[model samples]
Target: MYLGVLALTAFVLTVFLLVYLGLFLGRLPFLQLDRTGVVLLGAIALVATEVVPLSGIGEVVHLPTLALLFAFMVISAQLRLGGFYDWVVVWLDRRALAPPVLLGAVIAVAAALSAVFSNDIVCLAMAPVLAQLCRARGYAPLPHLLALACAANLGSALTLIGNPQNMLIGEVLRLDFGDYLRVAALPVLLGLLSTWVIIAGLSRGHWLEASASLLPSALGRAGEVGVPLDRWQTFKGLTVAALLCAAFLWAHWPRDLLALAGAGLLLTSRRLHSRQMLGLVDWQLLVLFVGLFIVNHAMQQTGLPAQAVAVLADEGLDLQEPAPLFAASVLLSNLVSNVPAVMLLLPVAQAPVDGPLLALSSTLAGNLLLISSIANLIVVQAAARQGVVIDWRAHARVGLPVTLVSLVIAAAALLPWRA
Candidate 1:
């Protein structure tokens, strides 16, 4: 039994290492593995090694994560169709505020939108809009691009539905939406403030006193504002989304059922192409969640998690308790990117601490590395298309310090909830 556990541990570790390498290195000699592909490959490795049986895999797969993820994707899908995200960015850009005030407004708006939608989508939709707006207004796009990325991450902490992992943590932990909000609201508030200050400081040194032509050379440069909204399709998506959110908050509906129903409603569209809705589904993210569930589930069944918990306890670090878990969460979140790191630690985290700590650490840690969060990458990629350069050095200038400040703020806020 011990030998089996050890071998399983080795297998899981090896799979994780390979996945990390693949993400960092990108395409291991034509294997061409991105993050999701790496996770799927890891699952295959576990199964092929005979270390995790099929039944054992079932025990570890987390349904709550998938359900909540699906729900938010549906909601975000609908919002995108509604032209909501695009409209919000335009409103911010058109405001005739001072540069500092404009910066604050941008961060505030980005944060609020990200609270209810996928921050990744929010950034993808808004970054180009923001870049062009800055160029048009004679301001550097870098500051706004950084603000969009950072604020999107910070804002995602506002609600249980903010990011994919928060939804998972909230659903699996059976946290009340209201209750989760009450708990997380403080840190999110503090985090956003810190983001603004940090961003402002970073911007002062970089903001150039020159205006660039706002005239979009290409239609794509005009951002989502210039795109024609399919009003009927937008209405269909929003109605389904609104009803689902109402069900989640008021009826306490089983999230999966509500989301699946919502997604079904959208599928019934007569005007919109089914392919377009399907394209917006974020299938890769879903696959990443499923793959991590299988791999982590296998690890738990092998008794490795139990042994590790015992060993940590012996070292005076019980993850079942809050503080150590919070510390562990921050460390691992930066190391492996929050979502997969959370999956590895989830089995050991018990209750309140698990929900809040996982949410806090994972979300805050995204500010640490350029590759730490998909939201960051989305913003970076979107900005790149607009000729706005934000390399690792530029990102780390803001990301590293913002991560530290946010984590510290979260630690203080979390002390009351730790067991």
Candidate 2:
């Protein structure tokens, strides 16, 4: 037993190190690894090393969580096919709103869309539109783009479908969608308000100068002009998505099957290349969830999770309670990114309402670092394409304070309820 424990501990430590190295370094012998790739590789390493018995893997693989994530991905994909996000961005950009007013509108729209679709996808779809609009209106895209990223992350906490991690946490905790929203709604509102204030402050005097007339040189060719609206297709996608959301809240439908069917129905398109839809699917994220599921499961088999909980308890920090767990979650989430950290901690904790706290803490915590969330990175990368760069220093200027403020609000709102 002692030998087995020793081997498992060593294996888990090695797996984590490899994952971090892959994330930080980007290349392994045969793999150009992203976060997902690194996690999956770590799972493979654990299995190859015999650190976790094959049977033990079952304990960590949460089928319900995966089902929820897969369903939301399909729904998000359907919306993408309908060009729903692009339509919204185009509409918003066409308005003659002032810069600060426009920034506020941007925050509201980004938050709303992210509450339904994947936040990362929302950022990717809107970033270019925002950048082009900013250049056209003679506004700097940097601050606005950063606002979009921060707002999207904040908004994702509003609904289970907003982000994959929330989906996983909600399903695993069997949280009622309506109830969870009620619990998280206040903090989310506060977070959004905080996002607007922090970003507006960062932009400072520049917000006044943000709307100069577009330079002649700033004029550029527009993006892949989308087709005249296929209203039927768009309606069909929206109907299916709305029904699914209602079903998830009210009915007992197998969400995965329903979502997959919905996605399949939308594929009846001769105009849009199947490749276009296929390319948009975030397969790496799915793979990352699966891999982390396996690795986190293997690591749990070592008894470390329970042991850690006991140690925390001895130190007057019980994760089964809300306050300490919330605090710990924020720290770990920023340390290793939320998804993986959630995977690490979820096993040992026990609280029915922990889901909301976990979801809120992890998602909001992404505001702490430039590299903290894929959604943040997506905004940064998209802005770079338009010659608007947001480096670590630029991001931290807003992210650090925003994270601190939001976490405090969320904790105050949740900790009392737990008591």
Candidate 3:
């Protein structure tokens, strides 16, 4: 028994190190493997080594989280194919609003959309539209683009369906959807407002000046040509989204079932082909979650994580406590991405506040640095394609303050509830 325990411990630690190394580096050095590839490889290695038996894979993978994520991706794809997001951008552009007011509007729209759809998808769809609009109007695009990413991250914390990590927390903890929203709504709103102030304040005089030359190829002629709205398809997608939200907030239906039904409804459309909708789904992300679920569950079986939690408790830093859990959530989130961070912390979650604390802290921490969230990188890469660069320093100027202020607000709000 002792030898078996020792071997399992060694194996778990080795795999954990290798997997997180790829996570922190964003890719394997001198290899083409990205973070998703790295985690998938780790899971495969564990199975191949029989560290986790092939038969046990089913038990390790969490189907509800995957189902919810897949359903939402399908819904987001429908909205994208229907040009709902593009219509939103075009509508905003046509409105005669000043820079600051426009910034606020962008933040609000991005946050609200992200609160329902995938935040990465929200940034992916909106960034190019926003960039082109800013350039056409002779204004800087960086601040607006950054605000979109930050607000998406903040807004995603507002509800269980907001992001992948939040969904996992809600599912694992069996949290009341309405209860989580009630606790999280104020913090998310305050965070969005803070995001606008920081970005607008930092970009005050620069909003009118063109900051970078637009690359014609990067800003494709088709992109600037404007996407025509298919109002009927858009309305169909919106109605399904509304119904799903209503189910989550009021009805006692299984969230995965409701979400999957909504996705199915969108897929049966005449104009939008299944191929086009499926093409927009992030299969890679779903695979990443599956891989991490197996890998983390295997690690948990070794009992090291539980032991570590007990040790920390002895040291007066109980993870079951709200404050320490919040701190750990922020630290781990910035180190690894929020999904993996939340997966690691989920086993220790017990308090009623743990669900919201993990959800809010992991999400808010995503705004702390450029590399902290995929949403930030998506916006930056999209901007870079248009010859507008947002480096670490530029992101930190806004991101650091927004993260600090938002976290402080979250802590003040949640900690008191614990008391």
Candidate 4:
């Protein structure tokens, strides 16, 4: 019986490591799969191996995380389909702002919207439009797109509902909505400023060029139809978003329920079909979350995590400590992505400080490496579709400095709070 437990532990550990390896490399060696597909496969392997029984799947996955993620998707989809995002990009571009000034504006707007809405959705909606706007003006699109990716990440740290991992952290830790803002606002603002500065400084001379890689002249950059702005639909989306924010800040009820209710209300719109709203929800990301949750829960049941924590503590590396927790959050986030990292370390999160520490570190860490954040991937992929290439080197040139500066600011901001 004891040997059976050991065998289970070893098998689960191997699966966990392999899953994270696939995530870090963005694919498994012989398999053509994305991050989502890799995790999904790992989850199936766990269930099939009976390391986690099929009947126990429901108990492992966090329903609230799924609820909040899906609901936010619907909200963001409503706003995007209303052409709110397109209008904002066109308006920003029409200002005739100088290149440096325009970069700052893009960063600020992306960060602010992401703080209220969802970061991935903000990037998903804004990246292509920003690319088109830049390309139309004979400007390079990489800097602006990088700003969108980095700032959206930094901004998402400000509010619990801003991103998926933040939502999970908030729900699991039960951090107060208002209090998190109060603590996170200053750091996030500073980080956004830092992001703008670094990206602007790095891309200074290149901004005006048609780009190093010229597009095929025959390609239709001129008359690509934009999502038309519908004022009434925009108003409906904005109204729901505003009320949801108010409820999140003031109401003490379960946030997932409130968000899901808001999504349900939006689906009842006379014009926007329920299918359309539901269609925009990132079923892939939701599936990824469900897979990771199941796999991690099965790993936790083996008691390996606690044992590892004990071993690390004996070496004076206590994960429950704030400083160590912060470092671990960043490292693990970079290694396996933020959501999985948080789920793995959540057991050792001992205080309210751990919550903020975990949330900020993990979110900020996304900016350091291109593959670390889904928002970064979305922005990069969106740009590619627009014939604007933003490779890892281009991103890291600004991303590394921006991440370092932002993390320092966050650590300093939380210093007094820790005391």
Candidate 5:
């Protein structure tokens, strides 16, 4: 009996470490596995070892979070398919706004959309188009792309539907939508403003590439951008999104169920095929959610995380407290990305105020470093295709300040809630 318990504990610990190692490194060494693959393998190993039985996965994984994530993905897919994201960028390019004003416009649109759509999807659909637009307008894609990434991450904190981790926090904590918006509004607004200031300051005198304008090669990647703006389709997507947001604020229904109903309505459209809409759903991320759910549950069941929290509390670093939770969230978020960090720290977030703190800190802190948020990576990758390179040093120069200020604003705003 003793040997069996010891072996099981060791197995769980080893698996947990392996999974996080892959997460932190963004890929496993020998297996060459990506983030999703690593977690899926870890969960499969645990179940194969009979640590977390397959049948009990329903209890371990939170279905509502997955459902909510999928539903929102569908909603965003609708907009992407309708070319709303492309149209926004094309509209901005056609405006012929000043360089500073252009940057601000991108920030505003990205942040506003991210507040409602999933941030990753927002970036995925917009970055390619925005990159081409910047190049065509005789501007380097760096400042504008950075604005999009930073603004999306910053704005995703405004509401639960904005990002995956926020949705998870909301579903797990059962937080009211209106209430969370009230908590996050001030900080998110301040963060978006800071993002614009930092980018605009850093990009002064480099806004327009005078000699590069009108290069035919700039639009070479237009094929990768989202579809053209179908006004009717875009209208349909907007209406559904508005209704979903209203329902989230006032309706008594479960958020996941409400979002799914909205998704169903969009999917049933005669103009858009169900497969086309479903194809954009990001099945990998949904599977990653499932895998992380099981692995984190297995970790929780091992009782080690609980014991560690107890020890930390005795050591005067109680995670339940606002300051420590806020700091830890920022650190963990930058370390292994926000979703995994949120999953690791979620157990201690029992207080009503913890939801807003965790969501804001985790999502906002990603702006500190390059590739810390998937939005950052998406923007960077999209720009690289457009002949622009934004290295880590460049990102840190601007992102570091924005992250520090945002976290400070968030802490000041949220800590008062606990009192």
Candidate 6:
């Protein structure tokens, strides 16, 4: 029996390492698989080898997190298809504001919207529009695009429903919605301001450079692909979104259930096809979550995490404490990406302060690199589609400092509340 357990442990560790390696590298080294593919492959291997029973798959997956994520994706899809995001971009672009003011506006809008919606979705919807807007206005799009990504990440840290990992953190910890926001609001606000300052300062003289040559082709392509603003649909999406936020704050209703209901309401539409809304859902990300949950649960069954925690405790690095937890959150978040890192750390988050600390640390750490967050990648890819190349160096120049400053600010703001 001991030997059998040892073999299972070894198999689980091997699969875990290989899966995380793919996550860290964004692909399997030479294989055509992305992170989602690699994770799915590892999970299939586990099930096929009987390391995790097929029937136990349902036991391992966190249904609430998955349900909440799907609900919010549907909500975001509704807003995206309704052209709400495009309206915001066009509204901002027509303002004729000066460069710094315009940058601030972009940051502010992105931050606010991201606080309510999925940061990744917010970036996905806004990046291309912002890029084309910059091209048309003869301004550099890199700064605005980076600001959108950074601000979205920072602001999403403010609320429970803002991003997937935050949702997971909230659900696992059973954190009070209003209380978490009270703790997170200040730091998130300061972080957004810091993002604006850094990006604005970095793009000082080059903000207004003409991209006339790049504009026509990009603008034409953008128009072809862009969703036009539908006033009625936009109003409906916004109304539902507002009510959902209210429900999260005021009602004692299960958040996942309420969000699911909201999604259902949006789906029962005459003009917008359900297929169109469903098509916008990030099915790949949902699958990735399922795969990671199964793998992590199997690893937990091996008792390795508990032993490792014991070792760390013996060394005086108690993970239950806020400081070490904060440090670990940042390191692991950047190492394996935020969602999986949060899943790994969820078991050790015991203190009252640990929930907010985990949420803030993991979310803020996403600003450390372009590869660190899906929001950043979305922005980068969206800009690339419009003939603007924002490479790693370009992103890091802003990301590193923004991450450091935001982390410091969050730490300072949360220090008084630390247990």
- Could you estimate the TM-score for every candidate? 0.89, 0.89, 0.95, 0.94, 0.96, 0.95
1-419, model 5: which lDDT tens digit per residue?
A: 99988888889999999999899998998787999999999999999987999889899999999999999889898998998988888777767777799899999999999999988888888888888777776777788888889999998999999999999999999999999999999999998998888889898888877576543333324564557679999999999999999999999899999999999999998889999999888999998999999899988988999999999999999999988999899999988889999999999998888999999999999898997999999888888887888899988988899999998889889867787
Q: Which of the numbered candidates is closest to the native, going by highest TM-score?
A: 5
Per-residue lDDT value at 274 in model 3: 95
What's the CA error at residue 24 for candidate 1, in Å?
6.3
Question: Which pairs of residues collide in candidate 3?
Answer: none
Error of 6 at 133 (Å): 1.0
Off by over 4 Å in 2: 1-5, 20-32, 49-60, 208-211, 214-230, 268-273
Instruction: Name the runs in model 5 displaced over 4 angstroms.
Output: 210-226
| lDDT comparing candidate 3 with the true structure | 0.88
Cα lDDT of model 3 by residue, 315-339, tens digit: 9999988888999999999988999
Q: Write the per-residue lDDT of candidate 2 for residues 182-239, one digit (tens) a residue.
A: 8888999998898888888778778533347644323233544342335666677678
Which residue runs does candidate 4 get wrong by more than 4 Å? 210-225
Off by over 4 Å in 3: 210-223
TM-score result, candidate 2:
0.89
* Candidate 4 residue lDDT tens string, 85-114: 887887787676676887898988998899
Clashes of each: 2, 0, 0, 0, 0, 0
In angstroms, the error of model 1 at 26 is 5.9
User: Residue-wise lDDT of candidate 1 within 1-419, one digit each (tens)?
Assistant: 98976766777777766776665554455776777888888888877776667666656667766866876676677667766666666666556556678788988888988887789988987887777677666677787788788889989987778888788777777777777777788988888898889888878855653544333222233433544455666667667766766777788677777777777777676665667666787988888887878767765665767898899999999888887888888787777777877777777767665788788888888888888888888888888888888999999998888889988888898887755
Report the lDDT of model 2 for residue 175. 73
The alpha-carbon deviation from the true structure for residue 13 of candidate 4, after best TM-score superposition, in angstroms, is: 1.9
Q: What C-alpha lDDT does candidate 6 achieve relative to the native structure?
A: 0.89
